[model samples]
Target: MNPVAIRDSYDVAIIGAGPAGLAAATLCAKGGLSTVLFDEQASVGGQIFRAIEETPVTDKRVLGASYWRGMDLTRAFRSSGAQYVPEATVWSLTPEREIGVSLHGGSVLTAARRVVICTGALERPFPIPGWTLPGVMSAGAAQILLKSAGLLPAGRTVLAGCGPLLWLIAWQYLNAGAQLSAILDTTPAGNRARALPHLLPFLFSGYFRDGMKLLRAVKREAPVIADITSLRAIGDDRVTHVEYRRGNGAAQRLAVDNLFLHQGVAPNVNLPMAVGIKHRWSDEQLCWVPVLDAYGNASIDGIAIAGDGAGIAGAEAAEWRGRLAAMAAARALGRSVPDPEETHVRDELARCLRGRPFLDALYRPARIFRQPSGDTVVCRCEETTASQIIDAIALGCPGPNQMKVFLRCGMGPCQGRLCGLTVTELIAEHRGLSPQEVGYYRLRPPVKPITVGELAALPKTDAALYAVTRM
Candidate 1:
């Protein structure tokens, strides 16, 4: 095998350029390891720290101080001589730690090394009638459109969801010259009271200060309605009106041109599952998170998961986990990790775990999954109806993987990010099994599509090595 023909190998391949990946790459490079950071986006700073080009950082308040911290971190990574590959989507991961990545101009590059998956989470879709309409989109999608692309939905938009992201979207939409009809937050106010005792100690003045800033931003622009029971988007071609059942059981309808809905996020674990990593259910977050230790080591050696890919801890927590994971990987590779620094990292991680009350209280999954409307679209890929999934379950489809074969729910361009959670719930309900038992459908490489020419161009020796590892 010609050495030049083989793709590059790194001491550490960080699979996402988001907060976690960026943090890990920065630390690993600084720690004297050859690091390469890969991201599907054109720039670093995953979803939480979305990248904006040439925009003056004048509106510091809107961007928040944490956002600026992430910016500084990216700068440090760039200066540390880490290879940053943007607009590169990693399609799959082999058990031997080789990553299949689709790059610009349809070229595929393989990076083989100790792997860290920081491939964050996707928004949980709340499917209702007219959800697939033109103007209806996930809350995170709306934020991305506004922040990344500087575009808004067609007209007046109603933001509906249960997370802090809803408030952020409302603030962004209002600032972007888009009219806001209302903000329907489904999170119950009582949740705060219930979780208050656990959160009180962590309620430093800074927490309240940030909350007040967000509250002041959206207070006058939109009405914040709490305890929303149900939502229905009604329109023939685009969103025209939104009907919601209030906490008081009174049905209310608002005339709106667009509707943005979200129900928090779940780990984008397809790549990890494809690599056969273990996972477990998170009852508090209501999703399946990859099984990782305190240092983000998965069951598989040389494979570490950090950030929302391990679980949906926010940016700060992700950064800590990323650093910890990198240190653990370094130690596994026969490098010495400073004992004092490792202890400090573990303590910081503990603090982050302690500060997660607001996130958990604000982002619980909606109870609406208990009774999915028969007509609502459960699988957006093949346009599989909820009824079809129900019937498939009735016909003895065992789980999501089998259901995908039967009904093609998760087999699409978006790869079930839009509909996987709902399908899992429906299958679990029908089979009388827990949602965790249904599990996410297994993901295969190429996680994303690759041209045949790219595959054929792979060095025969490398391909043979990959084949041997598979056996």
Candidate 2:
């Protein structure tokens, strides 16, 4: 939605209402910039604190303290006087800082002096045999249900993943009295040795005691099967069982009504990439991340990235980063920010990021999981399998974009969100090149799916219509 702010063009337009977006909006507005925050959610909190303002789960223990922290952040955003547009979907962002947004069957173009993307992360695709079955979904989707609707798995369910998010979800389900059949951890046993190099900083970091407590609580209540080497869902029409194998062990099956899969999260890069921001493959996070300066400025002028979209730092770090980025933007606009405020945000951001290397190394999914073979479905949007991608590589498919023309891997409704990483990795493995060499989809705007009827219905300026229709 084109927010009717005090000015037709905002000094800053923050695209998200998660921690980073909220904090950035607050800081920018208080520093005398006309700021606006847009989000697709009905409320202000992003996924990390989804439904913080309207959660049905009243018990704080169910969501934990970190989730509640969004309350204060949202309150500050509201008081900062930034125009908050909920249920607004920003479909396109240009290098010139122009925004094409849609809301409630209407669309408009808004301009901003600067744009900060806080569109966080997407759960890394976990491609396995039978994953496209109806009863299988990502762990992130299940968590959304819990947070937004106070819903829980009604029948036998298994959570298969190796990340702090998976463990946190398991602990929350236990607190909310949901039944769990098992927790399958896919972290290779050897990763502990790899993670040991970063263990000293982790011991002193804030994550140490809290992560241990949550892990122990979930282990006490649920059956945890660790060192999983391989996993797959099994069903005819819907997933009914999960088959997984541990190191040098026979495959075992568990009857399950639902399967929630995850490995880790990567930046939601579609918006950034569509606008021509430079990106590179991150070996640590196992995904593509935008190349950015220290204060969250991207390669593009007047655009910045914060939150997990910058990288896979946690919720608290995203908030601090929001402040830093917003303060930097404010300074660029000739506004004065207190020196102490900048120092405080930087210090806290550093503290939150202290143990991140350890987590990245420890929970790194095994190569077998990342580079699946055989009938495993890598691209769910198009139903493209691992063998299909491999065959494309064998037949002289150069990269992901070329495969899109032939195999239609990233040409679906998601526009490469679900399949981009897996396809890149598959090509990289088969071609004996780095993911960097394989590259990613060359995305352009309309970065999101929009109906022609909706666009035509909008009262558009001549320039707006020409911009969309022109080459």
TM-score, predicted candidate 1 vs. hidden true structure: 0.90
CA displacement after TM-score superposition, residue 207 of candidate 2 (Å) = 0.7
Query: What does the lDDT come to for candidate 1?
Result: 0.77
- Give the clashing pairs for model 2: none
In order, the Cα lDDT scores of the candidates are 0.77, 0.90
Question: Candidate 1: minimum summed lDDT over ten consecutive residues — where?
Answer: 1-10
Error of 2 at 365 (Å): 1.1
Residues 167-253 of candidate 2 have per-residue lDDT tens digits of 999999999999899999998899999999999999888999999999999999999999898898999999999999989899999
Off by over 4 Å in 2: 1-7, 457-471
Cα lDDT tens digits, model 1, 233-324, are: 88887778899987769788888877888877888877888889998877787778887777888988889999988887677788888888
